[model samples]
Structure formats: structure tokens, C-alpha cells
Target: MTCALIYRGNDILLCRDENDKLSFPVVDINNYDNSEIIYFETDGTQYAVLPEKTAETIAGGVWRGLRESWGELEPKTWNIAAKGAELAHFMQTNRFCGTCGTALVKASDISRRCPACKREFFPSLSPAIIVLVTRGEEALLVHAKSFRRPFYALVAGFVETGETIEECVAREIYEETSLRVTDIRYFGSQSWPFPSQLMLGFTARYASGRLRWADGELSDGGFFTRESHPLLPSLPSISRRLIDAWLNGEIGGK
Candidate 1:
């Protein structure tokens, strides 16, 4: 997050630890010249991470000072712990190859080389498209079938093969709700690393169609006016930023 440690300009590029609890595990780097890095064992139970959070935590400082303030620990921002965990997971899984059952190992540097098939593997990322469909002052929001009781967010979906991001946006909206969309506008992007997903956010104008819900995915769908809506669920996602921007206008609420 400090803008130096991360590479590739790939959304996050890099990680740092920001643990506050004394009960959290400590990383003993005495062997590595007593480096300040802290280590912790992760069982994939917490933080959606690997067997531990140590290597990632020590490097968490990479995100410090890059954020305008620490209070804004939003998903759009990447931290060192997350980056390290992602890398570890990426490497761990690349240990096996789908084409062949042979074992795999890291190449000279960043590339992963399979010993059996001579295939090279690199880190992977899932692309998600988040779009805001609006009509006049009203915008469309859908409640996920899983979180229908507690949360409701805007229309969003993952990218499918052979379609551009904008094309995917239109198709997803049509599939989820039998509606048409136009004036697709690029808003921003966010890193939704629940397990590593790169989300691309956009804003669109409603072209036509009545209220409809996608089968089995969304439980509810409707248009909402921020000023006159019912008591909606609390905002808990970087994906919600688009709706927020549209709701409060470009300036948004502080």
C-alpha cells in the first residue's frame, strides 16, 4: 500500500501486517537477523489464508502510509498480509498441474515450472464485474440469495468467456433480470480478495424491462431511491462504492 513494495501495477501489486491483539501469534525472525517480521499459523479458518499469517504479517508494513488513514481499512486497499497469503496459496496450488500429475516447482524467479510436462504456471486472478443500473434518480439493487436476510447490493457478476467486460455487464444484467441497459460507464475497480477476485465496477443507465430476478441466485430485485428507501442493510463492501457514489452524487457523504 505504501506504493513501493507492490509490483506489476496489478490492482494491489504488494502486503503488510496490522495486527492489534496481543493474543495473535508472534513471528520469531531471530534466525533471519532478528528481523521485525512476526509469524502466525493459519489453518485457513481465519483471514481466508494459508497455514499461518506470519510471513504476511511482518510485511504488512508495506501498506502503511499508503492509505490516507488507517481507519479506512476498506477492501479496495491491499495489505501485506493479504498479498503474502495470496502468493503462498498461489504457489501451494501450483504444486500440481491439471494437464499432468507431475509435481511442480518455482522457476528461476516468478514463473512456476512443472517437472513432468515442462509447463509454466503463473498466479491467477478471477475477474468480477460490478455494475450499477439506474433509471432517472433510481438505481437497481439485488439481494443475494445467500444473504437475503441481512444484505442487499447492486447487480454484479463474474466474467464469462469470449465477452468483453462491458458485454459481460450487459449479458449478466439481462440474465439476472430480463432487462436492457445502455450508456455503460466505467467507474472504478476494487480488489475483492475473499479468495482473490479482481472486481471491475461500472455505472449504467436503464434502457428497458420490468422487475425480474435471476433464477436461484438473487432472491429479490428492485429500484431504490437512497433518500426514500426502507431501512436497508448496512454498507459492507467495496463493491458498494459505485452505488454510494451515485447516491450521494460524485462528492458522496463523509
Candidate 2:
């Protein structure tokens, strides 16, 4: 009811007191000036985005990225709180209407309305497709240029407008590794809120082509069997789930 998600920049405020248990600092919202704060609610819980100056004053756990805090927070709490954080980011960036430069006001729980232009903007979720491409006992894993570390992951790309998920899957696989794939079947989906993404998971069978990096987009890639798999992405990611499924023989009909 009275919970808040205080954030500073891209990091959230997580505190671990003398006992070393992780928690967010509880703030008295009324004490803060409303104009300087951004707040939102998710599933009946109130969350406030503390100003950087204000957040820095709180004592305890260091500010951490959402991914870094994941293991310390409950799964359901992290999911809901992360949504609140995303909403906070949206509101901060959308404070004014693009067309008329008018200040936008909250239209509903998840949208803002521009009174002058009569335009309503809602929170956006960018859809991305991540697929595990299998060739018999081996699966294709790739290292993208954007990854923070050198771990491998399934081929993934954002779904373009006017393209189906399956089409996006096929295009991304080929674009990244020059590989053709078939049996593009939905596996599962996840809400990855590192700035808002809906990850659509799939499993596909390699139809043709050899593993070749897509120049600037992919650094390296190859088809690897379970016994010879490389370092993987974080376990909390759907990419990891798809990879694990393939490794366990849950996919590819092995």
C-alpha cells in the first residue's frame, strides 16, 4: 500500500542494513514536494521515483541496476516494481506533448493526454523475437555486439512493423548468422523491462546455411551441442530458458 520504488537515473535504490537483507527505503511521500517527484501505481501499490538528489540522501544499500537487484527481490515483486520503474521513465520523458509542446496530464493509469492536441499516449512495449535454432543435437548461439559481456544467447531481434513474429524470427536468424530455419513455433514469452521489451520466445530447426557473423551486428556465433556449450546469458532471461529447454531435449524433437 505504502511502498515506493525510489530510483536514481537507471538504477533503483536498494538498501541492506546491518543484517544485510535487501529492501527499498521507505519514504514518507507527503514530506517530499510533489512537483519534484514522479509517482505511479501498479496492482494497488504506490511507487515513487525519487529525485536523484533526494535518492542520494537515503542511507543503506547502494543504487543498483534492475538486473543486479533481481536475485535479491521476490520474482512477483520485481516484475510489478519493474513495471512501475518503466512507467516512471515513460512519464519523465513524456512530460510534454511532442506536437504542441503542451504539458501532458495523466489520462488513465497507463496513459497521458495532451489537452491542446487531444492526443493520448500510452506506455509502449517493444516486441522482440528470440529463438533457439537447433540442428539435430546442436543449437545456434550468438554473441551480439551490444552485449555487456561475452556470453552467448539465442538469435534475437526486434519485430519490425508489417512483419509477423515468425517472419521476424526467420529474418533475424538469417540476418545474424546467415542461417535458414524452419518450424518456427512459439515457446513462451517474458516481459523484459530493461527499458521495456516483450520477448517472444520460439524454437526453430536449422534448414540451411553455415554460421557466419552479420558483420557489425554479431561478433561471433556457432552451432554447439550441449556438451560443448559456451558461457550463457543470465538465467532470469527467457533466452536462457529457451537455451536450457533445447539442452534438455525439450525442443528440436531429439
Candidate 3:
């Protein structure tokens, strides 16, 4: 009923048991009494976050990032574990009230309350739009300035205030690749919790304009047919799903 997500910096602790099956070092909350712990529940299962020192002591080996061992972890485990990490990070950063500078207390399972100012804070999630722009038999892929690697991905940007999801999609595609797109259709969505992002995926047909980078944000971009497609983002991402769907002729009517 109870489990623990132990984190050390950007990495997480994955325990390898005697049977050689990898699992999280989950423990019953009642069995381990820790005053400095904050527990949260997801899907009727309770989970707690371990402190840095406790996590290090318990972790035999640490996985550098979730992406590295994503395939090994189950989808449910990944989602809950990432949510646990996000809650832990939120609690750590919001130790005190921002408005009144007073120590905050747990308001609910997923919120914090300031006693002095009666202010409540909850976990923050940012929404972003990622679109696969297609032109006939080709899809537009872009290389962003922020990517650590050389592979290309679908055009994506954060949704600005006062903008609809469709508008954000159109604007992001244009801003990043200098291309206009129409027939925008909702494809799918994914919860990308690297630091809490909800990625909204869409498929849009190329309306007009040539392929051109947005100078500062985008390094390069171009439309490529399935036969001549360049390197792409890895699996386990909505962007990759969109790209794969297009390549498999699932998006465009082939």
C-alpha cells in the first residue's frame, strides 16, 4: 500500500534485488517513522519521498535519469514515480511562504498552505504544444537551439497566456520553422514530467511558406519524406510517437 521514491540529485534510486529484478526501494510508511517526510497518494496507493541522505544510504546504485532506464520501468511505475519526484521537488522548494515569509504547512495531499497569509500553493505544471507538420508525403522536423544532441524533433513551444492550443500550435510551427500550417487536428497527449510538462500533440498540414529556421530558437529544419528522413528523437516521447505515426502513414492519408 505504501512505497517510496528516493531521489539523489537528478538521478533516482533503483534497487536490484537478489533475484536480479530491478524495482524501486518501496517501504511501508508506518514501518519507517520519519518526521521530515511528505507523503502523497496516486491511484489509491500511498507514496513518500526520501530525504537526500536517506536515499543515498538506501540506494545501491542510482540511475542517472529516467530516460536512460525508461524501457525497464513499467509505465504505471514511471508515472507514479515521476509524480512523486515532482511532489518532492515542490515541497523542497516551497519550504516557506512567498507572500508572508512564514513557514508553510501541508494543506492537503498535494498542496501547501501558509498559516500567516492563508495562501495555498500547489504543484506547478506547464503546458506545451508539439505539432507534426506534414506536406504531402513529407513531415517537417526541426532542430532546436536547446537540444543537447543533434537529432531533430517536431516543432514545439510553451503555450503563452491568452492563447488557444490551436493558436499555440500554429504560432510555434511558424515561429520555429517559418512555415504556415492548416488542418490542425488533435493527435494525442503525454505527461512529460521531466520537470512537469503536459505535451499536447497535433497534426497539421503545411499551408504555405518555405522551410526556414527562426534564427535564434531554431538551428535548422526541413521537410523530409519517409525514405529520406534524418535522425529523430527517441521513443517514449509524444514527439516520437507523432513522428512515428507520420512515418508509418498513420497521419497523412497515404
Counted clashes in each candidate structure: 16, 1, 0
Least well predicted 10-residue stretch by lDDT in candidate 1: 1-10
Best by TM-score: 3
Check candidate 3 and list the clashing pairs: none
- C-alpha local distance difference test of each model: 0.59, 0.81, 0.81
The sequence of per-residue lDDT tens digits that candidate 3 reaches over residues 19-107 is 87667786656655566677777787778887766664464755647665566677888877778778877888888999989999989
**Deviation (Å) of 174 in candidate 1:** 0.7
Least well predicted 10-residue stretch by lDDT in candidate 2: 1-10
Model 3 misplaced stretches (Cα beyond 4 Å): 28-33
Rank the candidate models, highest TM-score first: 3, 2, 1
Q: What lDDT does candidate 3 reach at residue 47?
A: 80
lDDT of 3 at 42: 75
Scored against the true structure, residue 56 in model 3 reaches a CA lDDT of 47
RMSD of 2: 2.1
- Angstrom error of the Cα, residue 23, model 2: value is 2.3
10 residues in a row with least lDDT, candidate 3: 55-64
TM-score of 1: 0.70
